[model samples]
Target: MADLSLEQADIIGRVALERARAGNSQPLTVVVLDAGGHVKLARREDGSGIARFDIAHGKAWGALGMGISSRGLAARAAKMGTFFTALAAVTEGRMVPVPGGVLIRDGGNRIIGAVGISGDTSDVDEACAVAGIEAAGLAADIEER
Candidate 1:
């Protein structure tokens, strides 16, 4: 699979931030991860909470690590909280079952990375991630479960 470049990651971050601003949401934290589940870039808007970055990272990592959107994971968690909690422990608290993490796919439909957003409602956060991924000329896999 192809890797998401720094330039693309930067674009995603910028676009996500802009989307959050346009919606008048809370100061957001955006995190982008490469195909290997490594962080390529991360941004926390001014006035964002201190733990926002951690939540963003966890969402992205969870999506990439599980090969599914964080929203899907969240859905599963809702149905199986105990198992999902175990999953969280297994991931050393890296995986977050939330609605903001989405997969980024390249032109050939290969997963390139993931993006996670925080500081807004789950649906709004997810919209920001999708917008950023699309703005970067990539596909956003925001699975709804």
Candidate 2:
């Protein structure tokens, strides 16, 4: 699968930050992952915590690995918290079921990977993530958002 370009990732970060600004969210952290759930790009704006990167990456990775939005995973987890906890353990603590991450689909609606954003409320984070995906001319599905 063709990987998301760094240029595209940069644009995604920029768009997300701009959207967050419009929404009154503080500094943000944005991460993009490839189809294999590998980091393609990560950006943390000034004042964003270093831990934000881990949160963003975890959300993106979880979405890609489960082939669903993090919000959907969170919903499923809400019904089985222990299972979701075990999943995090199985992933070596890299997976997180949250509302801030979304799968990225190409023009054909094929899953290409995901984008994650953190440093705000889950709803705001999701908004930034969705904005990034849409700005990249891709589709984002957050069934449980």
Candidate 3:
């Protein structure tokens, strides 16, 4: 069983909001998912663009589905463009090979779910996402899965 819970999701969202505020940028959208890729929680900060939420969700979903961080996916996509592109189509465009998503892991490095943030550059978004996961006391790899 996974250790992920709604409380952790809330913590992640709060941390993301804090990071976004610290950066003095637009509001961010945060999403958290369970091991099975089900949404555990999602928050759309006020003034965030509507599209931001979808991007955040896609990142989180992709992380959970791949059992790895979205950053890893992006790297692989760069090496295998055609295959990754086809995967996006097969996933109905839900699988996004972009940064801003990090897979949550337990103390033993067991995958739990993922957290994703949007409303900034891909790098900034990914940093915020990783920050939130760290704030929630979850283990996550910033560069690799």
Candidate 4:
């Protein structure tokens, strides 16, 4: 399994922030989590909400844990509301089914980590994450329905 490097995590965070700025998004919080669901890096822009970190972490962690983009999770949640609610309870609120969490894949298509961004609309946050992952020469997996 390929591991997520510190350099890659840094690049993802930096580029995501730049994308957010270029898109005129409200302040953002970005979190990168290794495949094992450990946080590799986290950043919060000025004016980001106080819960931004937690929200970002939850998004990444949820994606990592479920082996799918949070967008997919959101879709699943919509169809299985009771199950998703149980998931959130079991995770103690760590799971956030939303569009901003994306899986990071290596050249071989192996998932190495995940990136989560919170701030603007979920779609905008997801776009920034995809940009950052691509900038780092990695693939961003967003399981679109």
lDDT of each: 0.92, 0.87, 0.84, 0.93
Candidate 1 accuracy as lDDT: 0.92
lDDT of 2 by residue, 19-90 (tens): 999888889999999888888888888999989999999899999888989999989998998898899889
The parts of candidate 4 lying over 4 Å away from their true place are none
Model 4, 121: alpha-carbon shift in Å? 0.2
TM per candidate comes to 0.96, 0.94, 0.92, 0.97
Q: lDDT (0-100) at residue 79 of candidate 1?
A: 94
Show how many residue pairs clash in every candidate, following the order shown. Answer: 0, 0, 0, 0
Single out the weakest 10-residue window by summed lDDT for candidate 2.
Answer: 1-10
**Could you tell me how far off, in angstroms, the CA of residue 43 lies in candidate 1 after the best superposition?**
0.7
Predicted structure with the largest lDDT when compared to the true one: 4
Instruction: Kindly report which residue stretches of model 1 are placed more than 4 angstroms away from their true locations once superposed.
Output: none
Off by over 4 Å in 2: none
- Expressed as tens digits, the lDDT of each residue in 33-120 for candidate 3 is 8888888889888888989878888888888777778888898888999998888889998887799888888888888888888888
Output the better candidate (2/4) by lDDT: 4
Candidate number with the higher lDDT (1 or 4): 4
